[model samples]
Structures are given as structure tokens and as C-alpha cells.
Target: MAAGEVTLDPEIALFLREMRAEWAQHPPLESLGFPEQRAVCEAVRARWAEGGPRMARTIERVFDPGAGKLHVRVYLPDGAGDPAPALVYLHGGGFTLFSIDTHDRLMREYAAAGGFAVIGVDYPLSPEHKYPVALNRIEALMLWLRTHAAELGVDPARLAIGGDSAGANLSFATALRLRDRGEEGLVSAILSNYGYFSTTVSDEAEARFGGPGSIMDRAEAVSYYANYLTDIERERSDPLACPLLADLAALPPVLLVIPECDLLTEQSLVMDARLRAAGVAAEAIVYPGTTHSFLEAMSLAAVARQGIADGARFVAGCLSR
Candidate 1:
């Protein structure tokens, strides 16, 4: 289907309209510094994070396992037994913005839906922290969970990792790191939600979804990559930085939640094909009439709830094994 002819789900469109209205109250994002921009974004997203499932138990922890301080929030749903299987979730904001708090309700929803624990990581952002810093810390978090799952009441053997956009990239990259270390068994499943896996945006996607009034344009996407990498020319091809270029063999079962109208949709499609070609069990579900970050509209969009429910089912099935 042509991009221009693709229609957005009515509820998702309303969510976007509300978001745009909230953003319009603030000054132009380009006029502000990174800190100010993030502050504005957090405020705008705060409203959406509210009024979701309440967790049975929530614990916050700060771990300094050598790669700076990593703050993590653990959400345990009602009826989740001791040492419950956990899904380590990462939030998306182009690796430059957003936080675990920004994605709080989404994590809670997963914990409730899957009947497991959810660990939300507040990894360091880009520009100030740069590449490898956030990746190192996230990898460290996984390794730490391996031996200390009891501490968080999580099942060390039945763990999964997932995220949206930049978070999705990190989830896959962390798995790659684990595979290289011969610890691929650490992650039993991968849940990728509209992952941003490549540094380049196709000309067709740019022309279709990158124009004005879009949630994310090609220029904004390029700027995000620039912010995450030290050298875009060199690191853009690094499989760790762009999982689309990574060797997908030996990774665990992967469920990709793709938003059909997103500018980064092509990246997920290409990644899905490469994963299957590499002999990995990978599934991609493209939600029709959706846009980037549409999953955040769970409070208002049924498609968003369906996406979350699909991911929860995938994670639950993988962990039960």
C-alpha cells in the first residue's frame, strides 16, 4: 500500500491531535536546549502515563555495577508468584529523550497482562553519555539480573527483553552482546515495538512520512542517530549501533510490533526478513492504520491495547517454556 494512501486509526489520530495541541503550548523544540526539550517532552508524555493498571508491588533500585548509576523500577502484578518471570523493558525517545517514568504505565500494563514482573531501566541518555555508555550499562543490568533475580523477585532463567524505538534497538543489541559472550540463553524472547534499527531513512519513507505534520520526520530521525553515535559515518554501519546490520543468527524468538505508518517501519520489515533468513524464529505484526509511538496511546486507542496484548502474549508464551 502507498504511504500517502495509508490511513491512521481514528483513535490514534485523535491521540496525536491531543499531543500536538499539548506540544503547541510550549516553545518550538529547536529553540530550546536538549535538557529543555526533554523536560517539555516528559511533561507532555506524563499525562498519557497516568490512569493505567496499578501494580501489586513496585520497587526502585540504584545499581552501580561499574558503568555509572543505573536506576531501575520493578513492577510486580497481582497473582505473580515469587520469582516471577520478568521482561526487562526499555523506553524509546531516540536514545536522547524520555525515561522510565515516561513509560511507567506501559510497563505496568505488561506486568498485569503477562502475569509477570517488569523491570524498567532508566539508562543514561546520549550526547552527554554517548554510545557504549548506555549499552554497557544495559548489558551490565542483564548480567546482574542473571545472579540477582531473586533480589528483584524475578526468574533468572525465564527472562525476556523488549522496548520501543531506541529501546528496541538496545534490547536487540544487548542480546547480540550476550550471544557474543556465549550467554544467549539469558534472553528467551525479544519484544520489539516499532524499533528504530537503522541510521538511514529511505527516500520513499522520507517522502511519505517525513513531511511536515508528521510525528517524526527524516531530519528528526537523522538528528537522533547523530546524537546517539560519536561518528555517524563509522558507527552507522556498526551492527551493534544498527541491529538491522547485525548477524541475527542464534537469537531467541523475536516478536516485532510494527506500526505500518511509521517512518521507521521499513527498518523493522527489513530486520524481520534478515532474522528469518538467518534461521531465527521471528514474527512481525504490522498494525494497520498506526503511526510511530502509537502504543503509548493505549489509554485511548484499541489498536495500542492490541499491540500491548500481543506483546504480552508473546512474552508469556516464551517465559512459560
Candidate 2:
């Protein structure tokens, strides 16, 4: 199918329409500074984060994991047992925007749907934190979790790491880091939800999905990469910064939740092929008529719910094995 030709799912389209309307009320993000831009983003996303699956137990903590002080939230669903399999989730904002609070309900939904625990990390954002700052903290957290899983009632052996967009990039990069350290088994699975795996965006993707009124455009994406990296030309090809360039062999199973209309869709598609070629078990489910960040519309979109459920099932299955 031609890019931009496929229609957006009705419910998802409605969600986008409402989001655009909400955003229209705010000043242009570029006109504001980073702090103001984040504030505006939070205000806009606050409504979508409300009223989702409630957890049986939720705990919040702040701790130094050798890199810096980090905040994490743990959600335990009803019926989850001690030493529960946990998915350490990272929120996506191109490494600059969004937070655990903004993605709270999405984390809760995963915990509830999977019947397991979900750990949401409040990793530091970019332009202030830059590359490897958040990655260092997150990797330290995972290593810390390996020894402290019992304290959090999580099974250290069954832990998985996953995220959307930049989060997905971090998750995969963390796995690669662990693999290099010979601790690859620490992550049993990876849930990549419309992951932003590289800095490159094709002309076709730009033409179809990077135009006016799109959820994300080329310039905005470029700005995000610029925010996250100190040197784009040098870091753009770094396997850690762009996991699509990494060796994929011997990694844990990966489930890629791809939205058909997203600019980054091609990255996920290419990664899927590369993973399989490297003998890693990888599954990519392309959601038709969907766009980037569509999973956040779970409150109103069935496709989002299905994507979450599919991810939950994949994680649960991987951990069980």
C-alpha cells in the first residue's frame, strides 16, 4: 500500500482529532522553552491519562543507582503473586518530553492486562541530560533490580524490558549493553511499541507522514535527535544510539508493535528483518490505519487495547518460558 493512502482507524482518527484540538489551544511548542513545552505537553496529555485499569498495589520510590537519583513506580495488579514477572517500562518522548506520570495509566493497563508487575522509570530527559545519562541510570537500575527483585516482589529471572519510541530504543540498547557484559539473560523479552530505532527517516515516510497536521514530522523528529545527542553525525550510527545498527544475534525474543502510518514504521520493519536474519526470534505486528503513539489512545481506541493485550501476552509467554 502507498504511504498516506491507508485510512486511519476511525477511533484512532477521533483520538488524533481531539488531541489536535487540545494542542491548538496551546502556544506553539517551538515558541516556548523546554520547560514550558513540557508543561504544555503534560497539560495536553493529562486528560488521556485519566481513568484506566486500577492496580491492586502501586509503590513509588526515588533512589540513586550510581548514575544519579532516579524515580520509579511499581504497579502490582490484583492476583499477581510474589516474585511476579515484571516488565520494566520506559516512556517515549524522543528522549526529551513525557514522563512516568504522563504514562501512568498506560503502565497500569499493562500491569492489569498482563496480570504481572510493571515498573515505570522516570529516566532523565535530553538537552539537559543528553545521551548515556538516562541510559546509564536505566542500565544501573536494571542491574540493581537483578539483586533487589525480591524486595520489589519481582522475579529477577523473569524480568523483561520494554518501551515505546525512545523508550524502545533504550530497552534494546540496554539489552545490547547487558549482552556485551555477558548478562543477556537478564532480559527475557523486549516489547517495542512503534520504536524509534534510528535517526534516519526515508523520503517516502517524510512525504506521507511528515506533512502538516501529522502527529510527528521530520523537523520535529530531527529536533528530538538533536536534543538527545551531542553530535548527531557521529552518534547517529552508534549501535547503542541506533539499535538498528547493532548485532541482533542471541538477544531475547522481541515483539514489535508497529503502527502502519508512522514515520518510524520503516525502522521497525527493517529491524524485524535484521533480527530474524541474525537468528533472533522477532515478531512484528503491524496495526493498520494507526499512527505513532496510537497506543496512548487505549482509553478510546480498541486497536490500542489490542496492541497492549498482545504485548502483555508476549511478555507473559516469554517470562513463563
Candidate 3:
């Protein structure tokens, strides 16, 4: 398939093929004004407000220790054992949108497929609390998980972390922090999907891969990066601010998923290179014919749904060891 032409996934191939012509009739994001973009995002999320596969056991309103009053949702596989392997998820919305309710389905599916526990943290967004605040919330969640491993029935020792888009960025930064603090065995693997990193976009990447794919636009990346940084100097070196800039050695094995149609594919690929070069065990898979945030459209997009399966497979392999 060509760069923009994606083959549909077997599960939703027919749907995508049929909807292609209809979706082409109108651009999804163009209708939104600056104010409406937030509303549009919320409206779309409300439509899928109840996220995840229907079969998993989900528990909501859990609190984080470090960030008092912070909330998280947990997904436990049906009949999963005590102290099961766990995967903590952070939702991606360019650090602006998406709540636990928005991504419940995807988290549940991951828990069910991997037969592990899934924790979804609803961290604070940027330009309000800004970069480090969100990262701090994530790190606190990790530390809290480690502290309450017994109560939560989580094997923090066999844990994995991951997220989509902005969430994936948090996971990457958290992994780096864990490595820096000599905290190994806290996470066995990480599943990163179209994770955001780097403010330095080449004119070439911007020119070629700039368009709509699934939920977000390729052009929005520049804006997201700008908002993420409160200070330009700090942005370059804040290991917590930009994970791709941090040292990758001593981190747990990672599974990086890069979708061909997303603008962040190049950024993710660059992280993959860094992880490998630093001797971290990492496997990055690029899903052809798909765009970013594919997992959110399990009901609508075929290849997007397949990416979830791919993620589950990666998690299973990472946990097997």
C-alpha cells in the first residue's frame, strides 16, 4: 500500500472500505473553531464514553498516592489471579482531552487479552498545569502502584506501562525516570502507540505526512509541542518533559507501535532507535494502512482494531519472560 493508502484490517476491512467514500465527503476536523475543537473532541469522546470490551471487570474511582485526589480506573481480566501482571495505561489527548470514561473499553480489552491487570490514570492536562505536572502525576501513579502492590493485587515486579499518543509519551518519560532512579523490575515492558516526542519537526515530515488520520491531525503536533513547553530551554533537557531526549539504557523492554498513517510515526521510530542503541530490549512494530489513535475506534476501523491485537501480543510476549 502507498503511504496514505492503508489496507483495512480483517476485522473491520469492510467497514473501512465502505466508509471511506462517505468520510471523504467531509473533513472531520475542519468544522471546529478553536473553541469547538474542545467541544468536538468531548462530543466524540462522549459517543464512545464507555470505552473497552464488554467482558472485562472494571473498577473505577481509585486514587493516586502522590497526587492526592487523582483518579484512576482499573481493569481486571475475568477470573484473573491474585497479584497478576499489570499494565497501567495513560490516555492520549495531546495532554488536553480524554478521561478514564473515554478510554475504558480499550483498557478493558487490553486487560482481557493479556490476562493481566490494567490501570488507567486520568492525569491533568497541559497549558493549565503544564508539562511536568502531568508527568509528575504519572510517576506518582507508578510509585503508588509499587507501594500498594499487595492491596491492588498487582505484581509491581512484573508490571508494564503504556498509552496512546500523549499517554504513550508519559509512559516513555516514566520509564526513563524509573531507570534513572535505579528502579528496575518495576516495569517489564511498555506498549507505546504513536507516542509524541520531539519539538523539532523537519520541514519534510511536516510537508509529507500532514493530514487527518482517525482522531487527530498531523498539523496539530506543532501546536501540542509548543503548549507542552513552558520554557524552551527546559523543554530540551527535561527528561520528564521529552522522553526521547533521555538516556534509554537500564529501562525495561519496550514494545513501540508505529502506525503508518500517523504523523508521529517518525518520532516513535526515533525512540525505537534510541532504545535499541542504548541496549534496551525493544521491539517496534509499524502497523501498515493505519493512522494514530487507532485503538480508540475498535468498532469503526479494522486496522486500528488490529493494532490493539498487536499490542496485546506485544504485552504477552513482554510478560512471558
The number of residue pairs in model 1 that clash at the backbone is 0
> lDDT of each structure?
0.94, 0.93, 0.73
lDDT of 2 by residue, 171-247 (tens): 99999999999999899999999999899999999998888888898889888989999999999999999899999
lDDT of 1 at 159: 97
Question: How do the residues 248-315 of candidate 3 rate in per-residue lDDT, one tens digit apiece?
Answer: 88888788888776667788889999989999888888876666666666767666667778888888
Rank list by lDDT:
1, 2, 3
Tens-place lDDT digits, model 1, residues 1-321: 234569888999999999999999999988999999999999999999998898889999998856679999999999888989999999999999999989999999999999989999999998898898999999998998899889999989999999999999999999999999999999999999999999889999988787888999999998998999999999999999999999899999999999989899999999999999999999999999899999999999999999999999999999999
Shift in Å, residue 101, candidate 2: 1.1
Error of 1 at 145 (Å): 0.6
TM per model?
Answer: 0.98, 0.98, 0.85
Model 3 stretches astray by more than 4 angstroms:
1-39, 49-52, 62-64, 211-219
Clash count for candidate 2 is 0
